[model samples]
Target: MNLFMSFLLLFLLYTDKLAGLNFNTDVTVTWGQSHVAKSRNGEEMEFKMDQYSGASAQTNADFLFGRFDMRVKLNSPDSTGTITTFYLHSPNRDLWWDEADFEFIGGSSTADYKIHTNLITDGIGNREQQFRFPFDPASNYHTYSFFWTPQQIIWYVDGIPIRVYRKLSDSRILYPDKQPMKVYTSLWNSTAWTGEVNWKNAPFSAHYRNFYVNACVAWRDGSNVSSNCKIVPPFWFTYKLLPLERDMIIRMREQYMTYDYCNDKEKVTDVTSIECANNP
Candidate 1:
């Protein structure tokens, strides 16, 4: 890693500045008495939930304002599911689902986060938005992040920013505007909206480790934020951010650098970029 990135990685390893709050390492709770797979060393824990629930449950500690980051590796193949999510909710019981999150979705090793502007009353219409970013999450480890202020929310991956969504309202009551939010993390299988239920190829697993939070900056905009704030860096972000000379930079930049959006055929140029093009 480059000097800056190396230091940042080390800081992430040793400090909780990234997560914005303290985490209770010894505490882990689950719904329906989930199963846990323990590592031989007895240091790591994996929580598993079977069966599909239309809704998701949560295991949370307390926090109101700050950044949240976690290292996670998702489990086996799944065609339809909600994946895992990190969230915060309004302290008021009457306004549940008036929250924000770093939601991990299945079938693709990526993170999708959203903000709900209203209570969990009307479905999908309460001024909600989503951002999806790629992570070779299964083959290796990756970091997920969220930065929240009273008016804005930012999502990141490995210190790389993916989305910045803001609440644009003047009404204080409807806004989760200034409420201290409690942190929550949970896993659920949402086969209906996510896609077809393909258990034959599914029931995939996801793993999480080295979770941390740091509350450094107060809620504000126009800070010395990284350039990675708007764009989801290429898959080679970790590799490219390493210390290297100019030539190496060019070579790595060329081979791995691409703007191929699978859904946007207009951006895809080569035959190799075509999905199933070799087939009938």
Candidate 2:
């Protein structure tokens, strides 16, 4: 195929695979509704944060396992002390609560931001990994995504796999397979994690568009729930990374990764975790 035809074919296939979600029907503004705005007939949404409050939205239904994607442009210049996030979180906040996060920590300049990723299982979370963006994330929208299944979780930036967490042969390591989670997006201030805010640069904003989800929806409590809803699995349930994709992940980590909890000897004295083991 010609270059133009090949590009067009790929675009068409991707759109067919993951259709865009409608904001009005698929999600609800959980907090700071006044600061949230929708455009492009509700296909695009923006979250604004200030000294007083921030904005947040969450998916209306719970999903067991899936691939979730969002195009995001973070808070711009002088956004210190702010955080923009897209994550999946369990509604139950009990001892076994689980979460997966993609947090953008704002810095003094648009190009200075960092991507912080973490996975929490059974209410314990120390597996923090951070990476520096290759370009200014706030300058344009980029697709950030994660694929979750029974065996592994993979994080992506602009469709490039950046990180992977797999369930090892050892069964002792806790995985987030049991709980159903809801997708969420938020823009908030967090001086503890980012940095002390210059209140002069208040009213930060983050834009999110082209939300997509391809996953198994959990069955709600009802009189006529179907058995198929709880049994059948999707193709992604057994997905594994190709050799080329694995090589790309290694290259991306080598070049852009800033911090990894497993490699921190001071903070993580126990090297028993699979991620800490050689060749893991």
Candidate 3:
């Protein structure tokens, strides 16, 4: 492994001693309790989806900024029309909510699987980017993670950065810095965006393990301020991409990216007002 990845692995190994939250104490099943299962040690969790219902779970604590990571093995093969999601979301569902998503849309075959990502600020979400995994995501567990700081939101697949969204000065492009969000994961049925479902492969399931978070926890009073974590400003709060990492991001985007909403002329009104306008 490279130096960066080695360091990340080391960090993950010591996560429990470095303030990692407990799964049973910090997380709770929010939907389809019957469909959510835990291991004998409570270190791994599973979410299942059937023709009847799907399962979801969320963290009890809210966070303002931090690095969130999850190792997931998507539903087994023939998982058409199923969607497995890991995301951070504000409590509100109206015009002023904030969210960041990592949604895996199941396909007919391993080659057809799509990793769809999106961000929403002030409830206006047109930022959608999709990529294809080189390996079969259902075959084994792969780490899907993201870093949310004051300046940028970066998506990563197996510790490799794939996409980034920066906070721009333009008022037209709002960022999610103002709201505290809770981490959530779910497995559900959806065919509107994904293709038709094959109920023949019923009872689709997703496995999750190694939930790690090193972030500024926020209070529960619905306030916009974060709690007084001793690390006032963690290294990640001001983290920037290194030259090598930037190069990797470019190469990955060119090779794996299938779609980017910023490139859609019909959907974006004034492209100049968005961050991608300058980056592209």
**Candidate 3 structure quality by residue, lDDT tens digits, 1-280:** 7867755754565354345455677889999999988886768999888888999999998888888989999987888889999999997778899999999999888788899999988988888889999789999999888888889888889888888888787887788988889999999988776878898898899999988878888875544465646355765567766555677778988999999887787677774346676442
TM-score of 3: 0.90
Error of 3 at 73 (Å): 0.1
Local error of candidate 2 at 7, Å? Answer: 15
CA-lDDT, candidates in order = 0.45, 0.82, 0.83
Error of 2 at 139 (Å): 0.8
Q: Write the per-residue lDDT of candidate 2 for residues 1-280, one digit (tens) a residue.
A: 6644554564456446785688888889999999999985779999888888999999988888878999999877899999999999987778878999999999999768899999998898888889999888998999999888888888989987888887776666668887788999999889987789887877889999999977777754652322223666655578666555677778988999999888777657543356556322
Error of 2 at 269 (Å): 5.1
Find the number of clashing residue pairs for candidate 3: 0
List where candidate 3 sits over 4 angstroms from the true fold: 1-19, 220-224, 271-273, 278-280
164-225 per-residue lDDT for model 1 (tens digits): 44444323223343344555556666666565545664344545566566532222234322
Q: Please give the lDDT score for candidate 3.
A: 0.83
RMSD of each: 12.1, 3.8, 2.9
Model 1 lDDT, full chain set: 0.45
lDDT of 3 at 158: 89
